[model samples]
Target: MSKNNSPDSIIRDITREFNTIVDSVSEESNFIHDRYFRFAFADPIRMAELLTLFSRRNASLKAFLDTIDLSSLRGARENHSTDKHIGSADLVFEVDLKNGGTTGLYVGIIAEHKSDKDKLVLNQISEYYHHLFLERKKDVPVIAFIVYNGEKDWNPLTETHFADYPEFYHDIGYPFKAIYLDVGHAIDDSEMKSLSPITLVALTAMKYICAKAQYTAPRSYRQVHLPLRLSA
Candidate 1:
């Protein structure tokens, strides 16, 4: 458990780390974010919190997430053979079926974290989704998510190569839902105090872009901008 629980500082640290790595390192920043994101999200607790928040918008998935055992998040891996590695983490789990009584199987929930620079690789992701179904026998629910954390960028769905020829892959429906969780938008000032300690600390490590100060100061003193999500 980390000592720092402040969301503001955490958010700042995330942006700083990402920007620093991209600016200084020889390697493209994708691998760095992939490793960092995997470690942070692999922690069942943090993953649960965000999923809980996401469940607010979805009813069926909400029910599934309620009893989900975070201990089952296997690990993350990226296929680096391609020139631009569109890294994705693997989250597999199986829970008791709400509909099926005793014969229920363990359902797999594969979540792919899409960062700022990541393009939409529908073919690759779709292929991976199929592999999970065929290669590994698992009841993959409709709850798989493609978490898009990039604020300003192209949409992963329409911007991909598949856009050119929809006729070829019209039958195969995309398995995962595109859930946007961009950190570019700061939390409202009024809602900051009410945030959970875990959420505050975890979100920074989750996904966030470095933003400019939104406020200005008075004449005599220098402008001091407080963090958007104040730690209570």
Candidate 2:
């Protein structure tokens, strides 16, 4: 039991360490207005630490890679200046997964941190997903995840898809799939138990702060729940 708890404790410790790393290396910070975003993606080294922390904390994501292999997995923060939006993904990179030494491939995971009180994250995630699609081929599985630290209890209203957004009227709008991981929705240990390792890592990351200040946190975790179901 003690050994089992060690990793979880380590995850929390790393969160503190990451905070320190960000404070020391971040170019600028405004805790009252941009506390969350500053904590997550402002520093490249902090971002790398976060990726490692999440991957290690979640068993499923860890199982997917079997072990950490920096030679294959690389993470970075890209400046995606688009006419459609102002913010870019907090973390973006290729993760190479080896399945029984027979199959090895790299899949992309785009992570966005949302920690505000507003619920306008749907549009942000939709835009990011579409942008990813435009840059990558259609065959590429660019999985999306939005981590939020506010509110709970969600049932996604997906029938009203991103197209329904009033701002995305033209052909410039991109379409892509996303998985929502809402930390607020984890009301109890059971729901947390139902969450996938990827989702678990996402939630753990969100508990700290948002990746960008421009985006609003969704009402719940409805946006990125697919990865949890897929992991199951």
Q: Pick the candidate with the highest TM-score.
A: 1
C-alpha lDDT score of every prediction, in listed order: 0.47, 0.45
lDDT of 2 by residue, 1-232 (tens): 1234355654553355344423422343323223343433433344444444445454554444454344465553343333212346665655555544436655566766554443555566666666665555534556555544543434232334445557565334334445554543332333444443333444444543334244433323333232333233
Model 2 clash pairs are: 179-224, 180-223, 180-224, 180-225
lDDT of 1 by residue, 150-223 (tens): 44554555544444576776445577544444433433334434455435433543333322223222221112
State how far residue 218 of model 2 sits from its true place (Å): 26
Off by over 4 Å in 2: 1-72, 77-87, 100-104, 117-120, 136-139, 152-159, 162-175, 184-232
Q: Please report, as a residue range, the 10-residue window in candidate 2 with the lowest summed lDDT.
A: 24-33
Give model 2's TM-score versus the native structure.
Answer: 0.43
Estimated TM-score per prediction? 0.57, 0.43
Candidate 2, after superposition: displacement of residue 196 in Å? 19
